[model samples]
Target: MSTNTLAPVLTPERLATAYSYSSYRQLIDELQAQGKTTGLQQSAALTHYTHLNVQRMQRLDKTTQVVPELREAVQNLQQSYMWLVLTEGWCGDAAQIVPVLEAIAQASNGRFTTRYFLRDENLDLMDRYLTNGSRSIPKLVVLRVDTLQEVAQWGPRPAEAQALFLSLKSSGATHEEYAEKVHAWYARNKTQATQQELLTLVRDLA
Candidate 1:
């Protein structure tokens, strides 16, 4: 799997220019207004997934519960950073994870801000953060707000969830089967795993 070598050259100014999540939502709204759907491309599956993710994000936004540990970790953050995320509206993992990330940022009390980029539209940026040579959606690139230097990164999914997904894939489970199981894991985990992992990352940087 290839990893990004050029990431170090990226600066805060460049990152700051990336589209915000609100902008991405505006784009989605425009598409819907045009009687078209989907974030980056036009396809029935993409449209369906896009709408599904919209609803998922809304529901999670209202319902995600942050544990005490995560709240404290974010509260104690001594420096500012940006969670520049590459995702698409059709990405299931993004639907599950992005809201939780937004919650974390919100709890950070302005120490952390998140920006969203459509993975397909930002191929160069996404390529720099690819997972195992694959352009994985919902890739969170954590960068220092002062210097834009990478502090840490997370995503695709939490480790435990990724493990379950890999297990199902290796067993030759169909896409539907694996997807159902992976989402069920998210439903059960309820952002705890993601929060804990992100807390560890933030603590290390602190």
Candidate 2:
């Protein structure tokens, strides 16, 4: 996890620079306006393929045992690796956090790029990311560009700990419930450790 500010105060100009940000927001807004509050299915359509990167990362771990090819690739372009998100227009998670990740990646000197994968049709690709016998969307997959392998990932959890936190605040959940869940989750996942690790990973790549 990296320690530098990973989320920034996004301005209009910065938002525009991220081509997918506005479009993604529109998709979520449209659905919400239509009374489609739980956009889980829609999110699945947009973000399922992110799991492929995870599979790729798993393979890298194994391959590096006998071959330096995988490790070499990560080491080579570690600095230019992209926070390649397999996202979609309708996903709440993608809409909210993708921008922040992009901002963080960009602040790191073009080290990250957002890439989309339509989960609706890319079922085969989506299979790579399946966990707990289910498919999920807005799966954030970080990649090492040189090796095209995944470095880290987090998602499919309840919206409380993610960018979806914005919406959960207004949803039916009480403040105490929300705070309790977030605190529990943060403790279970060791978020602070992950952030430190992320920072170290990026710096090492640099």
The candidate maximizing TM-score is 1
Off by over 4 Å in 2: 1-19, 37-78, 87-99, 118-121, 144-180, 183-194, 200-206
Provide the overall lDDT of each model, using Cα atoms, as 2-decimal numbers. 0.79, 0.46
TM-score of 1: 0.89
1-206: candidate 2 lDDT, tens digit per residue: 22232433223343234335345445445554554422246444333323332232233323322123323333445366545445554443343334444444444445566654545545555566665555666555565555555655655443346544445666878755674565455446433333343444454555
- Superposition TM-score, candidate 2 onto the true structure: 0.45
Assess every candidate by TM-score.
Answer: 0.89, 0.45
Clashing pairs in 1: none
Using lDDT as the measure, the top candidate is: 1
